[model samples]
Target: MCQPPAVALSLTVSVLAESESASAALVVPHSPVGHHTDLDALRAWAQHCDVVTFDHEHVPQEVLAALAADGVELHPSPDALVYAQDKLAMRERLTALGLPCPRWTRARTAEEVEAFAAEVGWPLVVKAPRGGYDGKGVQVCREPAEVEPWLSGVGEGGLADGLLLEEAVDFTRELSIMVGRSPSGQAAAWPVVETVQEGGINTEVLAPAPGLDPDLATSLTEGALRIAGELGVTGVMAVEVFEVTRVGPDGGTRAAYLVNELAMRPHNSGHWTIDGSVTSQFEQHLRAVLDLPLGDPSARDAWTASANVLGGDYAELYGTYKHLMARDPGLKIHLYGKGVRPGRKLGHVTVYGGRSGDLHSLEALRERARHAADYLQGVVTE
Candidate 1:
């Protein structure tokens, strides 16, 4: 039998749920919870934990490496995480591996970016080489003129340089596959999820996506697994993909999926797992990092979907949650403790129990999600 420690861990907003898990043991500063990014403070806090992981990709690799050097266990070692941290490096490595990816190039100057655009044509995608998350560092340029501002960067340190440009992918839709691997190299994967993006941000995710062909789902999962293995990822990873309709070499309609981005930890798209699958992403993350046996990633039902409530105005939303629950008591909600802005992920509403014949139409589900979102934004009252 093991006794619980007085304090178990220290974490920023990203690992709030993990910090609260009974298995991990909750630990916090003497002061109340708020944004605390001090490296020294983080190091001291992490030292007390059995192992350390991340909720975001923004942490400095050097800092993580230092922690590892000091005998602190950091999963998905800095070496592995670098691929997720640097956009150019990831694209270059994946390209080298002969993976299917959108045409992309790195630019150190505005002139170079313009040149790349000239070759790829207008309506391009521009991204920061580092420190960009959500929809922050991504820019869709219809012409060369729209490229310079994103190339300049945007943040507290002013515009960052060294950006990457990719040819806009004209795809049917986007999908995400979540892969989880243990430190021992044992791996597991969840259902391929169909992700709906609005304004460059993910607004909803459907598991065992409606009308998803089994072959396509198989291909997506295999691609996700291969990528995780190649990267030697030690924990959970979510691979964002683009499903494109294109002419095959034989010249006929064929469905193709291309890798879009990589996330090294639990992801928003996996939120549906809480109600839809036997093992949720958060629990799987803990198992992988702790070197414990992996759990079954099977779907609990035929289908499940999660809709995110973006923007601020939690007060109104909080007030209406009871009403929503009153109507659909089975709905599962996960709210993040963060200051919300327009298009920011504040919380999510998940609904399961859908099957092939009696499926909830996408629009109907979207309406329920929208009503909740509106209620949260104070646009609607109970």
Candidate 2:
């Protein structure tokens, strides 16, 4: 997330133009999260570049098609990118592909919603078909009345695209599989990791998903690759999956998995790979998009934990970051280079262990990472 495009475009463009490294590059300030980039500006920028790759799914579909028409190569072509841009399309495609997802339907009207709820049961979820992120556009409804606020705005014609409704999953934990693929069809997957979320924002990531069942992990990796291939993905993709407990015929708990969402870009969940893996997601993404040889996706350590640093009450990041470096040299910090505002994602810290000279345990790594993040955000003094 760069600053909102309309707000920062002129300054961002001028800065990039003057930068030595950006001599051949034309830059556009990205639209804020969950909004589409300006099509005309994006087209102009793409005209100067040989190939176009994306870091977010906020570009409009028509913009992608136009770029392709302009003879600029696009990784994750518009046809494949549609699923990531629209949840309804994603659900339909995944279901058609026999991939597991929650029971869901189109919430076109209140009547249709009631009918779907009658089958899926109460406490279902409602989601905007487009432009929702970081907990926005998603809602949990325990009853019918809770849905009106969303549907009321469409007027008499109703929403042609409509909203999305799904059975709220009861998951033990959220897991993400990051995979990189090329147009040549080669694919590599990083170990599945457990993501910790608060208020719909991802706060921490535990790599290798502590004690994850080996067989299940394998299934997730292969399945993620299968999806990437099916979607003709040509860059790193993050498949958000869930590990849920299902009751057996005899009423015993059995672990099962379901696909939650798909992100066709380097995601927050894969940030730990920057420090803990043989290849970082950002590097791998470039390799994939360029159709170059893929890099190894193996972990450098047995455990790695990544914590997000949100802007807190304290505005000065300098002193807190200094304290973190002095206190934990193993911690790696990455600042997004954005102006900080309360609760905004400013940066992230990664810490790894399970080596001879390192923190020895997974919990220790987690604590170390979290403390670094908290300290940087000025949430914790020590």
Candidate 3:
């Protein structure tokens, strides 16, 4: 069985005893990625490795550029990774590329924000250009006064580089497509999946997006591949898109999609591929970054559903797993070994094996996955 190279593991390991084995090595770090001081240790660490890749996009572009200049192999070069790191940059680049995207502009003052909102209509979305994820550093402003806090913070140097304002898209559902690309130019894409969000955090995902239009699905998949190639990305990339449905003159609904955001790593949206697809995203990412031949991304089951286990009222998550496993032996539960905190992602549960065309069967699969996830998170019992 092929496995990821042990040299590229994340630096932060709480369980040192278990992680420090004869086959793997560990490195102590400075600040988190993006800080000037963080690069000092990373430079030293990269000197000994053949190639370096990232699990997240927080590393400062200057640091990545410096590493590349020093002859270190950094997959998905800094130029490509910037789109994932900065929201404003991403919107500008994607728009310039002629990709479908929401109307947006950078707002440095209350006047600029109000002007954009007036032109596009409220409620507008305000987002920090950098260092925001999982619904953090983002807000929906229904009126100009609602944006005063962000506007005031910009003047005080609290909001870095101002904020990004976008016309809140009117969409029917959220979708995501995962694609893997190699330095050698080979690329592969997984089936698009429907993403369910609650309180701005993704709570569940249904693979292949039940009832998705065949033509729309093909277009989105191709769009994901095109974006990866155009950006010169050399790793797995997840493209978050919004599907908009409109009533046609004939009274039938027609759907189109817009590019929402990008994530150049193994994203939560693809976690279902772990047990539901022929090749998991984790393995595909490792292969892409290493420039190895890519793996097949075909689905292993007719349908698959993955539900995230967010930290909830229950702190003793492990205690509930026995009941969950016994209730559904087919459910695959994954825990990250982290302390519980409300709304934090603790882990996820994936359930597969159902006929895709059967709505009842699909709902059953989703319920099974959600039930196990909820039980572990202490959301339900019996």
Candidate 4:
């Protein structure tokens, strides 16, 4: 996460470049929580860095705007980043771009939600316009009975000034495509990974998603690239797509993928690259924002799988490293140094290794990864 404000980068590169240590400098900037970094401190630090980028798009737009005005280079400039920051803006832009997005309408109250739902159908998906991450600000509404209580509770403008109502989708599988581009227009794409989410939060990602037809991958990649290019996106961005199935006239089934959402940074899905690919997303992000040459994204091994340790007991789970290491000497675990609360993405574990083109099956790799995670959390005996 320490890719911006030159002082932090210098300290980080110095440490990582040294062969002995792997720990890097991390710059904590001002956030909505008002707990850590503040804007003045960040602006002062930005004077030293050659370029700046992000791991998440939560930085206030005004701060980015002020930085740009003062001659700081922000990759995927704030103008472009806005689409990723605000869902309302993103939906409008997607429609203007003629992309295939789920049909949606905006509502400010229960009455509006009911009207929008009637116009569409029952069992709609409602989302807050801003500040919603993972599954926190989303709800599934089967009818007005479920909508009124939520409206009265949040009072529409208080928590969710604007709510989005969309038709629920029935899909075959969810997939993510990570694409990166340099300022010079050099672009690279990574292998697609199938994602599984539980209770609105991503829980697992299987690399080189099995059974994905070559044609489908090609189309998805091309579409993702096109969108990035049109949006003037620089650095790494992940596009999540849902594969929807429909019945054909001749008693057959047809498949089509729809754009689910876009994230313009190093996403959790790309975390597998730390062990599986020649270059990880974190490094590529550094290159892109620095305007340096992009690196190869090809997987060095055949298979890779990632499992998230989510919504767990942190205090009871923090000190089990020895047990985890005992069971899986080969497993690679990365724990984000954030206090764990329920479903907070405390960290991830990735497992991968095999012949160049003959990786282990997803089921086998995922099982091993899960076991390693359970061991680390003391849920299973080592």
Candidate 5:
């Protein structure tokens, strides 16, 4: 829920739903994260604003605290948001709550990392406890030497929460569930979606994860809702989970899931909900943030696949869409209206309601979404 370019669409959708003109103010941080945030200007702005919500998690907690002290209402208060802002806090809290998570520990020195690596075995994940997203502050270290550079930078104010080391999970697939909870305690969940990741960025999403076990799906959805309520999270939160396989003592493998991460705002995984669900995540977020009753997050399509359209060589996206619209009229395209930079997330496309069932029909939907995404990026000419 950080400052992704796609947040423009979420804001637009929310504004349109409320039939109100929303003002978007950009706060250019003087430095990356923390005190660099222009608190004085923000405080002045918040004085006139009714409710201040965030699109990204980079806002410093102190800033939020200062605003709250001034009585500026903020959704997903700093108390609940600390979990999303700091991986260490999230891991500690989730684990303490008996929620399933990868076995992890905080490391301030290379020795600590190596010690943990010995227990977890080689190939562990090292992450920045704060200010990390899209795999930027994360690293996979197979051995102690691989963690040297990052560890050297730890301690002091460099790595605010030090370094986080965890066992690199052997997951079957990535799954994400989106849920919205209001201050009134009303909560709703959408179908669990399988996420396709490329370069650590979510590349595509399959709504109602194809071939997902009903029991497993129910468990994930329920677990996500439980997380929101337990964490005191209001507004839409996407719980990213890792679906893993467990073998009982009888040598029978069983499917299970574990919490991997949490986003306290609309996430890329829920982009498909815009066109495929009864109520989109954007609108749901606004409702929850405003303390309104939650929306029904039911899917309107049997098979919906959302493909992220990355910035590519081509720039004439508007012209290319002419051919795309004529080709697949059902394709739902959402562009961020930002200048294209190679490999940057420009926007996403969603295709739903082909009446496709399970894996059989989902492939076509996936391909259609993929092709449209590629075409818009000028990766596919025909």
Candidate 6:
């Protein structure tokens, strides 16, 4: 999506939202996500921009500390994006950086969520540490009267300073690494995808994740480049892991990985690196927020699967685009021109090199990217 021989520019804050149909000399219009609390219109849109980024991480760390006190230039700064915009400050800074988290806490009473669910037991996981997404402020309580309407504020907001719980991980899937630092610290990683969630969004991904374990994909790309160099992160961070699978002590079978969420932008599990890597987590997040020099996230195929195209009851997705481009002429679809509801996310479909690219089978690249995303979400038709 960072197209053109890259000289980018598409800033949005949805001034009448028309999802990136670029060219109006490259769309601009700021102030919308959380309604930018005007600081001289974010310092006149960072004095006509030279560097300032974000496609989500709900900006507003005091409007990125008043555009870094007016000097602007924020590629992940804002204290490394408040650990991807607060989830109880990303589980207290990834459990004080020892990482491998998921047995968390922070209840604020329903008697501290029934004493942290009687010491972490009953179907835990509660969340809402500031504006949740996809799964919407999460929940899965299993009792404590379902966290009494988010601690009696009914629809969140009266969360009354409380909600974060955890301890539901039994994972054996959901991976995703994607790095790319820069702003001089230079970094780069990729290949470590597997996603595929459902009600909580993210429908499919797969990439270098089919049977991973090349030393656990080099320890999940060196722990996502050490959490993008201990959080000084510049651009493109992604990192949502949780692959667990235990049993050792000579009994055989082991693999562990945690750290479940964090995305400083350019995700959807690296959208299968656009067309399957060799550079493209949106051009390495525009060459690491314009610090330049960064590319080659490797994988130009051996398998690349993508798939997400949620919105349903198909509102004429170009009438099945000539039968999904004559039935997968090397499928690639993208779409996002918004306006469609039921479980939103309106586009995605990538499929590359399989069946002669020698099906490096993951169910043959997830049945050819879920049959071109279930025939562009009309949910199959031949």
lDDT against the true structure, each candidate: 0.74, 0.79, 0.82, 0.73, 0.81, 0.77
State candidate 4's TM-score. 0.85
For model 2, the superposed segments whose C-alpha errors exceed 4 Å read: 1-36, 155-160, 250-252, 355-360
lDDT of 4 by residue, 167-221 (tens): 7877788999998887777788899888888777788887887667777788888
Descending-lDDT candidate ranking: 3, 5, 2, 6, 1, 4
Off by over 4 Å in 1: 1-37, 151-161, 312-316, 357-366
Range of the 10 consecutive residues with the lowest summed lDDT in candidate 2: 9-18
TM-scores for every predicted model: 0.86, 0.88, 0.90, 0.85, 0.90, 0.32
In angstroms, how far off is 158's CA in candidate 2?
13
RMSD of 3: 4.3
C-alpha positional error of residue 143 in candidate 1 after TM-score superposition, expressed in Å: 2.1
Tens digits of per-residue lDDT, candidate 5, 1-382, equal 2223225433322111111121222222211221226788677566655666777787788988998999988888898899999889999989988888988999988778878888888899988888888878888888888888887788744286689888999999999999999888899999999999987989999998988888899888888888899999988899999999999999998889988889998889999988899888878888888787777899997988999989897864788877999999888898766668888888999988666465767888899999998888787888
Clashing pairs in 1: none
Best candidate, TM-score-wise?
A: 5
lDDT of 6 at 12: 35
RMSD of 4: 5.0
How many Å off is the CA of 262 in candidate 3?
A: 0.3
Candidates sorted by TM-score, best first: 5, 3, 2, 1, 4, 6
Q: Write the per-residue lDDT of candidate 1 for residues 154-213, one digit (tens) a residue.
A: 442313436778999999999999989988988999988889988788888887767776
The global Cα lDDT (0 to 1) of model 4 is 0.73
Task: Score residue 323 of candidate 6 by CA lDDT.
Answer: 80
250: Cα error in model 1, Å: 2.9
Model 6, position 164, has a per-residue lDDT of 82
Cα misplacement distance, residue 333 of candidate 1 (Å): 1.9
Q: Could you tell which candidate, 2 or 6, scores higher by TM-score?
A: 2
lDDT-superior candidate, 4 or 6: 6
Worst 10 residues of 1 by lDDT: 1-10
Q: Give the count of colliding residue pairs in each prediction.
A: 0, 0, 0, 3, 1, 1
The runs of at least 3 residues in candidate 5 whose Cα sits more than 4 Å from the true structure, single-residue gaps closed, are 1-36, 156-158
